[model samples]
Target: MNWSWLGPPMDVRPLFPVERGAFLDLLNTLTAEDWERATVCPGWAVRDIAGHVLHDQVRRLSADRDGHPGPAFEPGEALPGYLARTNEDFVRTARQLSPRLLVGLLDRLGQELDAMWAGRDLHAPAGLDVSWADPGAPAPTWLDVAREYTEYWVHQQQIRDAVGRPGADGPRLLRPVIDAFLRALPHTLRDAAAAPGTAVTVTVPGPAGGRWTAVRGAERWGLAPAVPDGGRAAAEVELAADTLWRLASRGIEPAVARTRARLRGDEALTGAVLDIVSIIR
Candidate 1:
C-alpha cells in the first residue's frame, strides 16, 4: 500500500464534514435494538463500538491539551484489558446521552477535528511510535490517525450492515483513507522484516482500479505504478479491498492471507508479502 501517494500531508479536516454527516444520517435511522447488536470487533456490542469511537475523539482532545503526542500504554500492557477499560469509561460518560445527544457529541467532535486541522501544518515525524489496540506492534502517529479514519469508515459500514442498509456514498470518498493505509506499508514491511528489495505486488480489486507494486531496495521500499500483467504477475497476490482492509486492520487471522489471496511466484516471497501486509494498522 503506497499511502504517500495520497498526496500532500494535510489535516483530516476534509473528511470531517462528510464523516459527520454520514454518522448523523446513520444514527437517525437506527432502532434501539440496533445499538445492542454485536459488532465484528470481538466482545464489543454496537453501542460499545460507538462509545469507543466517541471516546477516542475525546482522548485526542485531551492529548492535545496535555501537550503529549498521545497515550503510550507500557510494554506488557494487556491490549484487550486496556481496550475494555477505556471503552467502559467511554460508555459510562456517554450513558446519559440520548441517541440524539450522542449524535450531537459526534458532530461536535467532528467540528473540533476539522478546526484542529483547518489551515494548520501537521507533519508526522519519521518513525514516531503510537500505541494501538494490537499489543505486538505500535504504529506511527500518522498511521495511528489513519487507522482511526479506517475504523470510523469501516465501522460505519458495520453499522449499516447490521441494519441491512446500502453501502456508503462511493469509493471516491474513501480513496484518500485507503491511500493513507497504503502509505503505511513501508513501516509495516520494515517492522515485519520484509523491508524493500523483495519483489512483490499487491492487487486490490477496484473502484479506482486498485492495485500496487512495491519493490524493496537496498535502502528503502519504492512503489511503482500498479499495472496488472493480465494475471501473469511474477509474484501475484489478489484480494478484495474489504478483505485486505480487514487484514491490515488486524481484525482476523493473518493466515487468512493464504486462503484469501491468489498467490504465484516464489513461496518465500509469498511469505514475505504476507508478513509485510499482516502487521499494518
Candidate 2:
C-alpha cells in the first residue's frame, strides 16, 4: 500500500511522532497474554521490548526538559558496557509495572516529545553525534532525529513480528526507516580505504524502494542521490525490504542476509556495507 501522506515532510523530523502513535495503536489491541509473547530480541519478551521503548521516550523527554539521568556504571566502564548494564536494569525495573502502566507512560511522553520537535530548528548546531560515525564529532540535528526515528520504528517492528502483526511496511513508513539506517553506511566504510570518487550503490527493489550511492570523498564517504554521470559504482548491493531491515539492525546474522543479498564489483566494500549497524551494541 502507498503510505504516502499529503506532502509528507521529507525532513524526517516529523516521523517519530507519527510512528509513536502507530505503535500505541498496536499496543492497544494486545491481550495480557500477548504482552508476554517472545520477540525477535531474543531474551526480551513483548513487554520487555515495550518497556525499552518506554525507556527511550522517557530519556528523550528528560533530555529535552531536564538532564539525562546518567547511567549507573562502575569505574573504568566504557559507554558500551555502561549502556548494556543500564538497559538491562531499565527493562528489569519496567517489568515490575503492568503493561497498562508502561503504555500510559509512553503515551504521555511521546506527545511531549512530539510537541518539542515540532517547533525545534533541525539545522541548529547539534551537540550529539551519530556515535558510530566520527565518534564525539557533532552531527546535524536532522540526522540525530532521523536516527531516533529509525530506532523507534525498528523496535516497534520487533514487537509486531512477535505478535504476528504487520506494520509500517508501506512506502511512506518503510522508506524513511531504510533511508535513516543507510545514513550509517558512509560511516561504516570509514576505515575501508577506497579511492576518492569510488562509489557504492545499495538498491532495495520495490514500490517503496529507492537506490542510493555512497561516494568516497577526500575525507569521508557521503550519501548522494546518484553516482556522477558515467561514474561506475565500486560496489553494488541489493536486498529485499524485510531482509534489509533485519540486516541493517543486526537483527539477523550477516551470513543469513548474504543468502538473500546480491553483490557485485568490490566484495570487500559490499561486505562493509552489509555489516553496518544503526544501533549501538
Candidate 3:
C-alpha cells in the first residue's frame, strides 16, 4: 500500500557486504561438476557465467578507477556474439586456475571494489561517456555499477538453479535492485502504448505489497498510486510483481502472463500494461 519511490541512489557501503556475502556463499557450494552445468544464459555454462561475472567486476573496477568510460561494446556485434566472446574469454582465463584460485580472484576483486568505493565520491564526474549496446541506453557509471549488484544476485540464482541448490536469500537482498529496475520502468515504457485513455494498476503480491499505476494520456503518461479507486478491480489488469519482473527481464513469457494475470476492465489493457514493463528490460 506504500507508494514510496523505489530504487533511488543508495550508499554502496551498506550494500556491498550483502552482495559479497551472497557471491561467496554461492561459490563455496559449487562442485567442479556443478560449474560444468549449462546456465540459462545462452552460450554460458555455470562456470562460464561465474567467470564472466568475475571478469566484469575486475573490468568495472578498473574503469571506475582509471576514469575510463566502461567497455565500448561494438554496435555491429549482435548481443549473443558479444556476450559469447566475453564469456569465452572469462572461462578460458578461469580454466587455467583452480576453483580455489578463481574464488581468491573474486575476493581480491571485491576488496578492491570496497576500497575504491570507500574513498571515492560516487557522484563525482567521471570524464568519459559510456554507452551500452542498446540505443538510448544510459551511461555505464557508478549507477550502472550499483545496478550490477542486482544482476549478480539474479545470475547467482541461475547458478543455483543449474546446480539444484536453493536460493536461501530472501527478498530483502533483491528488493533494492528490484526497486531500481521498477523506478526506471515508466521512462522506458513511455513510447510504447498498450492503450489510449486507460489507467492501469500493476500489483505485486508478496508479504509486503507494492503497486504501480500507469495511466495513458493523449500526448504523455503519468504514474501514480494504485489505491482508493484504483485497486485491482479498478485497473485493467493485475499481476504478481515477481511474475512481471521475470517477464520484463525476458526471464519468463508474456503468454504465461496472459494466462495467469487477472483482468478487469479490458483484455487489451493487460497487453498494454505488459508493453509498458517489457521495454525496461
Question: Which candidate has the highest lDDT of all?
Answer: 2
* lDDT per residue as tens, model 1, 62-116: 6653456544555776655666666676677676677777887888886786665
How many clashes (backbone N, Cα, C below 3 Å) per candidate? 7, 0, 1
The candidate, 1 or 2, that scores higher on lDDT is 2
- lDDT, residue 155, candidate 3: 69
List the global CA lDDT of all models.
Answer: 0.60, 0.80, 0.60
Q: List the residue pairs that clash in candidate 2.
A: none
* Candidate 1 deviant stretches above 4 angstroms: 1-12, 65-84, 124-145, 191-196, 220-234, 275-281
Candidates in order: C-alpha RMSD to true structure: 4.8, 4.9, 4.9
Task: Give all TM-scores, in the order shown.
Answer: 0.76, 0.91, 0.75
- 1-281: candidate 2 lDDT, tens digit per residue: 11111112247766666788899999999998889999888789999999898888777777765676665669998888987787888999999988778889988988887887787666664577777644677766666677778888899999999999997778877888887777777788888889888999989999767887888878778777678677889899999888888888889978898899999999889898888787777
Model 2 CA lDDT for position 87 = 80
lDDT of 3 by residue, 112-159 (tens): 877777775555433332221113444334545555665666667778
